[model samples]
Each structure stands twice: as C-alpha cells, then as structure tokens.
Target chain A: MRSRSAWTIFWRTVLGRAYPRIIGAQREKSWVFFEIFLPLLQVTAYVYIYRAIEAPPEFIGFVVLGGAMSAYWLNVLWSMASQLYWEKETGNLELYIVAPTSRMAILLGMALGGMFATTLRAIAVITIGMLLFHVSMTVRNVPVLLGVFLTTLVALYGLGMLLSSLFLLFGREAWHLSNLLQEPVSLVSGFYFPVRALGQVVAAAASILPITLGLDAMRQLLFPAMLGDLRFLPAEVELGILAGLAVLFLILARRALAYFETLARREGRLSIRGQ
Target chain B: MRANGSRSEALRSLRVAAWLGWQIESNWADPFVFAIYSLVKPLAGALILVFMYAVIAKGGLQSPLFPGVFVGNALFIYVPAVLAGISWTIIDDREHYGMLKYVYTAPVNVLTYLVGRGVAKTMVATIAVVMMLLLGTLALGVPIRFGGIDWPLVLGSAMLAFFGILLGGVTLVTARHNYGVGEAVAGGLYLLCGVVFPLDTLPSWLSSIGRAIPITYWVEAMRRALLGERTALFSGLSNGALVAILAGSTVVLAVLAVLVFRLAERRARAKGLLDMQMMY
Candidate 1:
C-alpha cells in the first residue's frame, strides 16, 4: 500500500469523523421533533412569560434569538464536550487512539459535524420563533454578524474540544458536570435577556464562555434599537474578544488532547467501561 | 398465599431498586461535588426566571407576581427529573448498561422498579424545590407562609408520580434509540402547565389543552398550597374541589399507567425489544 502524508491522513480523518454526524443527522427523523420542535416550544414558553409580564415587544425578539443560539451551546455540551467520554463508554476511543491520525483531527471533525447539525436546528428555531411571535430584527451589518457568529462557533467548539479531553479523564463525573453546565451556562450567558441585566461584574466573568459574548454581540447587531443600551460591551470589543477566545481555546484544546492521549495510554483507561 | 408472596416480592424489588437508583445517581462524584452538582442546576434554573423577571418587571424580584412564578418554576423541576428518571432507566439499563434483559429475566416487577427509580429523582428534586423556596423567602422575599401551607393539598399532589410512571410505560414500548422523550414531554408540559406563566397567558385553545392536562392542575394546586393563592383560572374551584379533581385525575393516571405498562411489556416481549440495542 502507498504511504499517505500526515497532512493527507489528517484531512481524511477529519472528513471520516464528520461524515457520520452530518449524514446520520438526516437519517434520523426523530431529531427534528426532539431538537427543533421541542426547543421551539421552550422558546414559546419564554415568549409567553414575557407577554405575561407585559414586557416590550423587543424582549420577545431577545427570547427568540436566545432560544436559537441555545441549540449551539447544547451541541457543544452534549455532542462535543461529552462525546469522547461517550465514545469511551461505547468502546470506540481505543480504535481512535490506535489509529495513526491526530486526535485533534477527529475532534475537529466532530466539531464541524456538530456545528452543521446544530445550525440546522438553530435556524429552524429562529425561523419558527420569528413567524410565531413576529419578532422583528434590524441586521445593520451582515459581514460583522457573520464574523462574530463564526468566531463564536470556533471558540465554543474549541472549548468543547478541551472539555472532551477533561471529561474523558474525569470519567462518570463528566455526565453530572455536563448537566451542571447546561442551565447555569444559560443563566450566566444571559440566554433569554441582555447580559447587562446580570450586572457588569457577573457579565464580565461570564464572558469566559464564548456563547455569552456571541449572543450579546448578535443581539446588539440584530436588535440595536432595543438592546443598544443593554449590551455588556460594544459589539466591536466583543468580536475581538471572541477572536482571541477562538485562538486561545484551540491552542489549549490541542495541548489537552495531547496530554490526554499520553495519560490514556499509560493508564489504559480507554477500554474501561461504565465509569 | 400466592398474592401475599408476590406482593412481598414486589416490595422487596422496589426497596432495592430505590437504593440502587440513589447510588447510581449520587455515587459518581464525592459528597461535596455531588452536593454542588445538585445545588447548581436548580438554582441556576430559578435564577434564569429571576433574571428574566428583573429585566422586564418594573418591581423586579419584588413584583407581586414573582412569588407564584418563582414557586411554580421551582416545583416544575420534578416534572422533568422524575419523568426522565423513570423513562431513562429503561434506556440506561437497556442501551447504556446492557442490563435490561437480565433485569427482565429476574423476579422483579418492572413497573414497581421504575417507580422505585423515580423515587430517587423525586428526592433530589425535593431538595431543589426546598432550596428554591428557602432562597425565595430569605433572599428574594417570596412571601411563603409555613403556617398557611395546605398540607393535604401538598401531600395529595405527590400523586404526580403516577404521571411519570405513565410516561415511562410509553417509553418502554416506543423508545429504542432516542433519549429525549421524557424531556420533550416535560418541555411541552412546562408550557401547557403554566409552570412560569398562568394558563390564561396561552391562547384560549391552548389554555383549554392545558386545562385538560393533570399537570396544569398539579402546578395550580401547588401554587395554591404554597402561595395561599389560587390561580385565577381555577379560582372558581374551592380548595376541596381542587383536591378532589387532583385525586380523581391521579386515579385515572394510575390506572392508565398500569394498563399501559402491561401492554408495553407484552409488546416488548413479543418484539424482542427488551434486549435490543441500537448502538447509535
């Protein structure tokens, strides 16, 4: 057999890893109901809560946008962060380790696949929510919105890659940790409101999570008239922060995956199940 | 003699299953981490509502409506936790742990075992509920009166467990690969049951659907018991009438749960699905 270059192998591994998530997503019909419709229902509930409170119409837009971005955060937590632990439990981690490819490539593939799948759900949420609630937005800057949005995904998935390694190291605690992160992250991230409403200090701390800045930035751009004063920072600064986060997380994730691979080899934890 | 022997066996299974459920849930982390784990999610969940109210309501947490909404959201945790606990047991044992076939072959009653598992989740959720109530009263001034609590209505509301078992029975026959069934139902009920908002907030057609669901009444009853105020939608009914309706609804749910479980058990056995693993 002809030898493949490291670059060739890495690219191929990424493609192979992502294939299942991208294609298999379409194969499963239940995901639409579970992922899209159910989340839409939750968004609807929040919308009703805002209505019940007699909040401004823009608040409904906030809930709709928050509900949309939440799909990505969930994908990061469950499908990306806890994935390697799941793979370990299901006895697939050993195969990936034994294979002669970069572990980061496998993770990148998972990230790409998860991003694609979750985007479909997120878009569905935003579209349906807009139609149902008549949420109006003023997207003044398309390029900036896309830039911040993409950077946010990069940083968020990078964080997921890092957590995947940490989660595998921690074993069963990862499941509880993942659960712990969900609602708390949503709260701190100001998923259904402006992060500014959480006050400056708390919002500053929550910026560690990429979605916090991402959601804040997107909302600022989309709902300038209502959310202009409520933004935690100027959208420009948030974009810069997101870019820095993207780079920092990718570097950290690379190092963590290397350390994890060494530890797993020495400890022989890859084959351990039900931990 | 046979009936007595079977009853004792079922009781034993239930007792053991509850212990096992608690162990599986809490033993993954040390006591400290587990305590933090239990505290954070529910508190954060409550905080989400608090922040939402703060942003919109002029009076912030002091809004007259805050207490009921806070209490309602706090109690709503049980719907998802218990429902997921019971239904996910089927998925966990069958799919994740691959022990469902062995469990089925044993002398255990699956329905009783599921109820036992749900008991552990109820305990966890009760802690969250109590913590939320304390935080509401002390920190947020939610106006809960310990003396005014209707103990009978509160106790009667425990019949909500039957709904979890009913959903679990549906899961036993239907779910092969999906894990979100419990959460999906819970999310829908969160909207329908007026967990955070009143039923009147929903459109009349949707509110009618909410009225039909046992959980809407369950939330309203809990609010009445804990907050000493009846939901305007149900204000027409007196406390006794509310309790009677809850009891009647619970009886219907319990009977339906048993029948559903029996039918699901027969179907699962016929389809050879008890041991089936999708490996997704």
Candidate 2:
C-alpha cells in the first residue's frame, strides 16, 4: 500500500505542476509566441553569420541542433534552477517544506515541467530550421540518438536540481548568479560550435557538462562528415557517464536539500527576503 | 512663479535619481565580480565568432576582416548590457520594489527621473565598452590600428549612440508597462540590431528594419572611423556628413521616446495598472 501510494503521489506531483505551467503559459498567447519564435531569430543570425564566412552546409545543421539544445539549458538555468528563488520570494518555500511530500518530488515536477516546455519550443526550432535553412540531419541510428537525447535531458535536469538546492541558500543574489551562468556556459559548452574547436584544457573543462558530451556524440553520430570521428569518447561510454551523473546528482540533491532545510530552520534564514 | 519652482524641483530630483540609480546598479555585485562579469559575456562572444571566422576564412586570422569582427563584437555588448539595464530600472523599481506609485506621486517629473537613471546606467556601459576594447586590443592582440582615425568624430558618434540607446530603453520600458512583453522587445532588438554581422547581408526585410534603427548608423560610423578605407557604407560621404546623420537619428529617437512615454503614462493611469502586483 505504501509503495503504491508513493507511485501515485509522484505522478500526481509531476502532472499537477506540469499541467498548470502549460495552461498558464498558454493563457499568455504572446508569451508562447515569443518564447517559441524568438529563439529562431537568434538561430537565424548565427546561421547567416556562418554562411557569410562560408562554413560548410553541415555546420549549419550543427548550429541548428546546438540552438535547439540551448533552449533546454536556458530553461534549466532560468526556470528549474531558479525556481527555488522564486518560491522563497513568494513565501511558497515554507509551505512546500511543511508538506508531507518529498522535496525531490517538487524538483521532479520542475524538471518534467521544464522539459515539456522546452521540448515544444525546441521542436519548433528544429522544424523551422530544417525548413528554412534546408539543414540536412541524417540520423545514423534512431535508438542511439534517442538514448543520447533522453540521457542528456536527465543529466541536465539533475544539474538543475542540484542548483535549486544551492540557490535555496541564497537571497536576491540568486538573480545575478543565474544571469552569470548564461553566456559563459554557452562558450564553454560549445553551444554554437564544436568543443574540439576550443583547446584541450577547455575541452577537458567542457566534459564537466554532460550536454557537451551529448552534443559531441550527437554530432558525430548524425553528421560524421562535419564532426568526423573526433569524440573524446565512444557514444555508449558518454551515455553511460551521463546516466551515472544523473543518478549521482539526484541522490546528492536529496541529501543537500535536507541539510539546507535544517540549516535554514536553525539559522532563521529561510524567510529572510534579501540579504 | 510656480513654473520656476517646479523647474528647480525637477532638477534636484534628477540629481538624486541619478545618484540612487548608480548605487542600486553597483551595490548588487562586488567590484571584482562586476568587473569580471562585464568582461566575460562580450569577450566570450568575440572569441566564439573570431574562432569560427579563423576556421572558415582562407587566410584564417591573417584575413583582412579579422580585426573588424573583433571590434564589432566588443561594441555589440552595449546592446545587451546597456539596453537591458535601462529597461530594468523602471521595471525593477515599479514592479519589483512596488515603488512606481510612490515615485509617480512624488513632485518629480517621470521623464526627468528616467533620464537621470539613464545617465548613471550609460556611465557603467561606457566602462564596459572601453574595457572590452582594451582587452581585445591588448590581451587578444586584435590589431586596432589607431593611425589616421578621426578621434573627435568617433567620440561624437559614440555619444550619440549612447543617447539613442537610452531613449530607446525608455520607449521599451514604457511599452513593457503597457503591453506586458519585456523579453520579446529586448530579444528583437538584440537580433535585429546588426550586432554580429553587417545588416546589408541580411534578408531584404530584415535589412530594412535594421536601417530604421539608430544603432545601425552608429555601428557603421564606428567601423568607418576605425577602418577608414575599407568601409562600403560611407564611401560617398565625408566624416562630417556621417556624424550629422548619426546626430539626426539620435534626436529623432529621443523625441519619439518622450512621446511614447507620455502615451504609456496616460494609458497606465487610465487602466489603474501602475500599482499592479508584479507576476513572477
């Protein structure tokens, strides 16, 4: 009975949060339009820029894929990771802590909700890119591509959950910290370009992000001509690493949440607005 | 009698607003982090584009256009940082701090107060621009050949560009207050501003939109001033004529911003939206 109830509660949490977000976003028609379409313009600029310099046709597909994946990273940074900051500011964190449900459930809801939102936007971006730029993406193996994509999402969201716990310890500075993550991550992760183009040290640093490995794997798998057989590791090995990181982070996040909650309670820090 | 009293009051309010704006902007991050943060985004962008160009171009970094790309990316930082900073001031104060109603009720004119904030924000932006330029020239070895450059014209063009951005920011904030779409407007400007590549090479409609913006002229003028003989845009015009065109566009944008702000104010008052709670 207890096991059954836990499963029920988990699905309830995920669906409850995800449904409202989709509805709330849809209520603001303009928000939906801008969020979906604005990214395309940015992608278009980079594509045009690459063309102006006369990069190969495959590089355009590389850019499109990177741009699509970047939506999830932005969602992780701005929405999932920063959700704790929003909850604290609005006095929802106390209610969440007081509830009987696990805090992991809340983060799970965020990860799932963010994934849903970003997937819709990313699909639109990919479709428009394929249509507009005539980007040719031939998947060598469907199962491998799907596995890498799902594993990337899991690893990325795990990182988001970890960040949520860390950001809970912050006050208004969370805003600045979130802003600080954007462009540097774009550079380090090689969002619009290949990581190999960056040097060895930077490539080593990029491996700390699972998205980087996932991107390399996807590129090599999809467009072997453009990227060549230059991955730092094999595809299955990268996928294994990503899966391991996701599980490790989810476990660490739960423990960190408990510790931070106790610290906030004992130190009387949770409700303090802006330090 | 009353007119003189109001004018003096407005002047005093402007001074205080400018001071407060600077403090609010700087106090969030410590000095070191703020300096690093300013350098990181613009420099990273420059690095990415330069690396890509080096990979694709025939002569790689030896290409004649390499320095232009470096300088252009550095200047592009102004659009994101300054433009966002200016819009956020009003949005933050009114929405986040819940002080818009109180500020409006004060004896100070809203336009004057906004202009005061713009001055402080512009000062910070100017520092970022200079820092990016220095880092590009010194650390990155982006050859910024300074000989035969018309210094006065460049400075005048930069000043005009800054003013245009400030006024454009005012128009954006007012529109956000009315339309409730901040990110869309900011994103559109970043993409449409000819930041990364030349506007001429963009699609015809996009290029037309770019020509309508003041930043396009400023960018062209700056490039012409920096790379004197290589400019295709101003081959027919003298440096004096270029400066005149820039100044003309700046004044037009400033005037339009003031008009839009007044309209926004009237709309907000009519709808009783000035005191609405900020949505997350």
Candidate 3:
C-alpha cells in the first residue's frame, strides 16, 4: 500500500473522528428531543421568571441569547472535554492511542463534529426562544456577532481539548469535575444574564472563559440600546480578548495533549477503564 | 411472621444498596475534594437563581418574593438528585460498570435496590439544601424561620422518592438506547414544577400542565413550610388540604412506580435487555 502524507493522514483522522458525531446526530432521535426541546423548557422557565419579575423586554433577549450560547458550552464540556474520559470507559482510548495519527486531529474532529451538532441545537434554541418570547434584538453588526460567536466556539472548544487530557488523567474525578463545572461556569460566565451584573472584578475573573466575553460582546451588539451600561467591556475589547483567548487556549491545548500523550505512554494507564 | 421476614430482607437489601451507592459516589474523590464537590455545585446552582433575581428585582434581595423563589430553588436540588440519581444508576451499572446482569441474578429486589441507591443522592442534596438555606437566611436575608418551619410538611415532601423511582422505572426500559432520559425528565420538571417562578407566570396551558403535576404542589408545600407563605398558585388551599393532596398524589405515584418497575423488569428479562450493553 502507498504511504499517506502526514497532511493527508491528519485530515483523514479529523474526518474519521468527526464522522460518528455528525452521523450519530442524525441517527439519534432522542438528542433532538432532549437537547433542543428540553433545553427550550429551561429557557422558557427563565423567560417566565423574567416576566414574573417584570424585567425589561431586553432581559428576555439576554436569557434567550444566553440559552443559545450555553448549548455550545455544554457541548464543549460534555462532548469535547469529558469525551476522552468516556472513550476510556468505553475502551476506545487505546485504539486512538495506537492509531498512527495526531491526537490533536482526533480532538479537532470531535470539536468539529460537536460544533456542528451543537450549532444546530443552538440555532433552534435561539429561533424558538425569540419567536416564543418575542425577544427583540438590534444586531448592530452581523459580521461582529458572527466573529464573536465563532471565536467563542474556538476558544471554548480549545479549552475543552485541554480539559480532555487533564480529565482523562484524573479518571473518575472527571465526571464529578464536569458536573461541578456546569452550573458554576454558567453562573460565572453569566449565561442567563449580562456578565456585568456580576460586578467588574468577578466578571474580570470570569473572562478566563471565552463564553463570558463572547456573550457580553454579542449582547452588547444585539441589545446595544438596553445594555449600553450593562456591558462588562466595550465590544471591541471583548472581541480582541476572545481572539487572544482562542489562540492561547489552542496553544495550551496542544501542549497539554502532548504532555498527556507522553504521560500515558510512560504510565500505561490512560486506557484503563473505571480507574 | 413471613411478611416480617420479607420486610426485613428488603430493608437489608436497601441498606446495603445505599451504602454501596454512597461508596461509588464519594470514593472517587478524597474527603476534601468530595466536600468541595458537594459544596460548590449546589451553591453555584443557588447563586444562579440569586444572580438572576438580582439582575432583575429592583428591590434586590429585599424583594418580598425573594424568599419563596430562593427556598423553592434550594429545595429543588432534590428533584434532579433523586430522579437522575436513580435512573443514572441503571445506566452506570449496566453500561459503565457492566454489573447489571449479576445484580439482577442476585437475591436483592431490584426495586428496593434502586430506591436505596437514590438515598445517597438524597443525603447529599439534603446537605446542599441546608447549606443553601443557611446562605439564604444569613447572607441574603431570605427570612426563613427555623422555629416557624413546619417539620411535618418538610418531611412529607420527601415522598419525592416515589417520583424518582417512577422515572427510574421508565429509564430501565428506555436507557438501552437513550441516556438522556433522566436529565430530560428532570429538566422538563424544572420548568413545569415552578422551581424559580410561579406556575401562574407560565402560559395558562402550561400552568394547567404544571398544576396537574404533583411536584408543583410538593414545591409549594415545601416553600410554605420553609417561608410560611403560600405562592399565589396554591393560595386558596389550606395547609392541611395541601398535605392531603401531596400525600394522595404520592401514594398514587408510589403504586404507579411499583407497577411500572415490575412491568419493565419483566419486559427487560423477556427481551434480553437486562444484560444488553450499548457502549453509550
């Protein structure tokens, strides 16, 4: 057989890894009901809560947008970060380790697949939430909104890629850690409201998460009139921060993946299930 | 004599299952990490509601409605804890641990075992509820009077186990191919049960759906016990009436749970699903 170039192998590995998620997304019917419909129920609860308090109409917009972006964060946490831990439990980690392809390519494939799947759900959430709650948005800059959204996904999934290695190293703690991160990250990232309401210092600390700034910037652009004073930073600065976060997380993820590969090779424990 | 012997055997199974469940849940982390894990998740959950209220309530924490919302949200830790706890045990044992077949062939009553398994989560959630309530009263001024709390109503609300077992029974049948059943049911209940907002705030149709759910009354009863106030949704009902309704609904739910679990167990055995593994 002819030897494939490294570039060809890398692309194939990416495509190969992503295939299951993209295809499973279509094959699985339950995820749609659970991911899309049930999440809408959660978003609806928040919308009703805002209505109960008689918060401004724009606050409803905030909840809907937060609900939309949260889909990606959840995808990052469960599908991307904790995925290798799950793979280990299912006895697939050893195969990936032995495969003659870059581990990063495998993760990248998972990220691409997860992003595709989550984007569908996120769009569904936003559309349904808007129609149901009548949430109005100004959308001052479409290019900027798309940029922030895409950058947030990149940085968020990059963080996921890094956490995947650490989580695999930690074994069962990965499950509890993922669960612990869920609500806390949502709270810190200001998923259901403007991050500014969390105060400057806390919001500044939370900026380590790409979703925090991304959501803030998107809200600023989407609800500029109402959130003029509520934004944590100017959209331009948040965009720059998100850009920086995207690059930083990707680099850190690569280093961590390398370290994880080295440690797994030395210790020979990464493939062990139920550690 | 026979009935007493059977009852004791079931109790033994339940007790052992509870111990095993606790070991599985806690042994993954050391005492310190486990403590932090227990503390942070629930606090963060409560803080989400707190911050949500803060972002909107012009009166801040001083809003008259804050206590009920805070108490309701705090107590709601039980729904996911118990519901998902029981259901996830089925998935954990069958898929992750690959021990469900052995468990089935054992002398333990699977139903009792499942209920026992949920006790660990209930205990953890109880701690979280107490912590959140303390945080609410001390730090947030939620106005919960320990002396004024109705202990009976609070205890009665523990009948939520019936609902969890009911969901677990459904999970037993569906979890072969569906892993999200527990969370989906819990999330749907979060919306329908008026955890953070009154059912009245939901559309009339959805509010009617909420009213039909026993958890709506359970949450309301819990809030009443904790806060000494009735949400508008159940304001017309007296305290005794609320208890009667909760007790009645709980009995019906318990019966349904047992029946469904028996049916599911029989079906799983007949269909060769008891040992089926999907690698999900």
Candidate 4:
C-alpha cells in the first residue's frame, strides 16, 4: 500500500506542475498585447472582404466568418521561429540545457503559450467583426470546426518545434533560419486571399500543410454557397491529408528534438547556447 | 583652476581618446562578418516571393497582377527583406557577444564611428540590392530599363537605408543597457514601413497612411526608376523632393544616434552596464 501510494503521489505531482506552468505562461503580457494588435489590423481586412462579397447579408456573413477564421492565421512563425534565436541571444535558453525537465515539454509549453495568445487575438477580432462590421456568424458543425482547429494548431506547433530543433543544432549566431520559415509560410498560406486562387502548383504545395485543408474544410461549412463551385480535392481528402501532414510534421519534430538533445550532450556546450 | 593642472588633464583625456579610437576600429571588424551572415535570410525571402508569385500567377487569379507586376513588387519587397533580415544583427551582437563596450571606449566619437558602420552596412545592402535587381531582370524576363538612373528613388532608398541603420544603431546603444524587444523593434518597423506589397493592397485609408511614410515615397521612387515610368519624372512629388526629405532625415537620424548612445553610456555608467559583458 505504501509503494502504490508513493507511485500514485508521483504521477499526481507530475500532472500538477503542468497547469501552473500553463497558467503562468499565458498570463504574461506578450500574450495580451500581440493578440490585441493582430486582430486590430482586421479593420482594414473587413473592408477588403466586404468588397469581395456580392450581397449585403453575404458581406456580413463573410466578414464575421473571415474575422473568426483569420484568428487561426498569423505571423507567429517570427515569434515562435525565433525561439532558439532569442534563447541564443538572451542566454536564457541555457536554462533548458541544465533543467531536468523534458525539452519537449519546454518547447510545447512555449508554443502553447503563443497559440493561446494568437487565439486570443482571434477572439478579439471576432468581437470587433460582430460589433463594428455587423457580422452575423452562425454556429453550425461546431465540433468539426474545433477538430480542424486542434489539428491545424498541432501541425503548425509541431513544425515550429522542429524549426527550433534545427536552430538549436545548426543556427548561425544570427538564426536566419527562423526568417526562412516565417516569411514564406505567411505568403503561401493564403491568409489574405484564397489559396485555390493560387492555382495547382501552390495549391498542391499548400495542401501538404494542415492549415490549407483546415481553411478549405472550415470555409466549406461556413461559406458553402460562396465556394460551392470551387473543387479542392473533396472534403475527405483534405482532412485526411491535413491529418497526415500533422502526423508527419510531429514525427519529424520529435526526431529533430531527439537528435538535437543528443548533439547537445556530445558537444558539451549545451549550456553555452547560441553561436 | 590652475593652467598647468588643466593641461595635464587635457593630455590624460587625449590618451583615453586614442585608446578608445583603436578599440572602435577593431570592434567594427564584425561588420565584415555580419554582411556575409546577412545574405542567407534575404536570399530565402526572395526565392519564396518569386516562387509564390509564379504559383499564384499560374493559378489564374485572373487579376491584373501579371508576371511583370510580380517583378515590380518583388524589387520593392527587398526594402523590408533587407531591413527585417538584417535588423537583428546589430542588437544581437551587443546583447549576445558583448561588443558594445568596445564601441563605447573606441577613440572615435560614437556618432562618427556609427556613421561609418552604417555606411558599411548600407554598402552591403546595396550589393544585395544589385544582385536582386539583376536576377529579377535577367531571369524573370522583366524589362527594368535604367532610363537614366532615377536619382530621386536612389536618394529615397538611401534615406530608407538611413532610417534602418540609425534606428538599428540607436536600438543597439540602448538595448545594450536597457532590454527592449529586438524582434518587435526590427519586425514592427518592417511592417509599418510599407516594404512588401503596397499597403494599398489593404484599403484606401490605410494606403494613404502608408503613402505618408518616407519608405512609401522611397519605394514608389524605386518603382518609377526600375519600371521606366517618366510620367511622374518631374512631378512636384518627384524623387528629388523625396531625396531632399531623405537627406534631412539622414542628418536627424545621425544626431539621434549620437544622442541615444550618449544617453545609454550615462545610464550604463550609473547601472554599471558600461563595464558589463567584456568579450575577446
């Protein structure tokens, strides 16, 4: 009974540490301000979306939906992309080298912090879209949308972690690798315009990422009539592909993380951090 | 108060000045290292922009954004590309490698030394701009006729370059002592500066706000020079007028850099940041 109780107590403590870390992480100011600033830019976006729509009601619907949908998109690849870069620069990243905590946990914690922060921006944007732009977004298939959101975040968060791993092992002192990831992703993701409009080649390249398919699938439910004529490899294929990409990116992220950890051990400069 | 004592003090200060000057020259050698490190990110950013444009054009957006427009926009995109990619270097060197102390102690006045460093970086950026221009014209098959070098755009870009270097230099001086967000300092400027696509891509009002920025005029001037448009050649909004503005800004920014450094040094002295983080 004593041994069993000790084992039980250990697992409980493990679970207990996470919530406080998560809470403390989100309460920080970076989360609050960046989220607010991102959605505030949507005032201009509403103007563009309204011009694209045919009817007044459709405009309201599209603007509201676009406001909510855009929350899922942003330029955090810079924020997250520079994880190793910032660490290497500030010397704070050195703590991770010595800490007994899992590197994966540390990375996931940071990403979750960023995602939640960006999601808050998404919320703020939707609030403005509803109040100012007079958007009347409907709730249909909430579960499906949530699933797509989870998977998209998972895939992106995974890719971000993988990039961090690369930077840890291979970054020049400057960590330009983050720029390599952030800028290209922003352009190709079709955040501003429809990816399908990007034609077959970009569309093909984008389909490999979960966000493209998630956006497509989510849009199908939200604006089915607007995009009804457009074919994007069918709903089932898009979701399956997104799921596949998420898994593939996660596997790659895990492998990269492990390789980096091993390399850190071998190099004996894990604590040195940065170039 | 005595004349002999004053002379001895002056000699001691001169000795300090020479030592500081020597330090400044040796420390600035990192510019050569930085200029090389700067190219990788912009090269990647350029390739992505070109590839995305090709794919988007091929997709038949069915808009007026022909391949030529892509080439046109691509050149202006480098303004931000250069700024964003390299913005971190100056600040990063100070915070990461502890190079700021050498800068402060160097014999040359900090402002004059920074002007030279800024020129070196601008020269590097100029080389990158040249490479990007040649690649776009030759490979993309776009006609960017020189049409007697638009001196205005050149001046405007020089001004934009000044803004980038000064803001970066100022940030370096302060951040060495006071911690501020480097990415925010760098990336925010890139977005706010109207470098990538025309902020006109957004709305009329936002575009107006974008147009109000010095970079807007600079990039517009660049577009005119490279695209061979003589229509706005001598308009009141001429690049010459903009170049004048740029020259004024260059002087102001240079003064501001000195001010920031002097302030930073005093603050660092109070906080002991001046003697902090010495590196070989």
| Cα distance off (Å), candidate 1, residue A275 | 1.5
Clashes of 4: 6
Looking at model 3 chain B, report the run of 10 residues with the lowest lDDT sum: B151-160
User: What TM-score quantifies how close candidate 4 is to the native fold?
Assistant: 0.70
B1-280 per-residue lDDT for model 1 (tens digits): 9999899988988898899999998998788878888889999989989998988887888877788899999988888988777888888888888998988889997778888888888888888888989999999989888778887777656566787787777777776556788888888999998889888999999989998998887788888888899877788988888788888888888898788888888898999888877766
| Regions more than 4 Å wrong, model 1 | A1-4
Interface RMSD of 3: 1.3
> How big a share of the true inter-chain contacts is recovered in candidate 3?
0.78
* Best candidate, DockQ: 1
**Candidate 4 lDDT score relative to the true structure:** 0.53
Chain B TM-score per candidate, please.
0.97, 0.81, 0.96, 0.64
Instruction: Evaluate every candidate with DockQ and list the scores.
Output: 0.80, 0.53, 0.76, 0.13
Comparing 1 and 4 on DockQ, the stronger one? 1
Q: B141-233 in candidate 4: lDDT tens per residue?
A: 556675566655665554544454545544543433222233344334344434444344545766666555666555556666776552222
Better of 1 and 3 by lDDT: 1
Candidate 4: regions farther than 4 A off: A1-31, A34-102, A125-140, A229-231, A248-256, B1-90, B112-128, B131-142, B169-212, B230-245, B248-280
Task: Residues A159-254, candidate 2: write the lDDT tens digits.
Answer: 888888888887766777787777777778877777777877887778778788888788878887744634566778878888887888888878
The best-first sequence of candidates by DockQ reads 1, 3, 2, 4
Q: Clashes in model 1: which pairs?
A: none
The TM-scores of all predictions, comma-separated, are: 0.98, 0.91, 0.97, 0.70
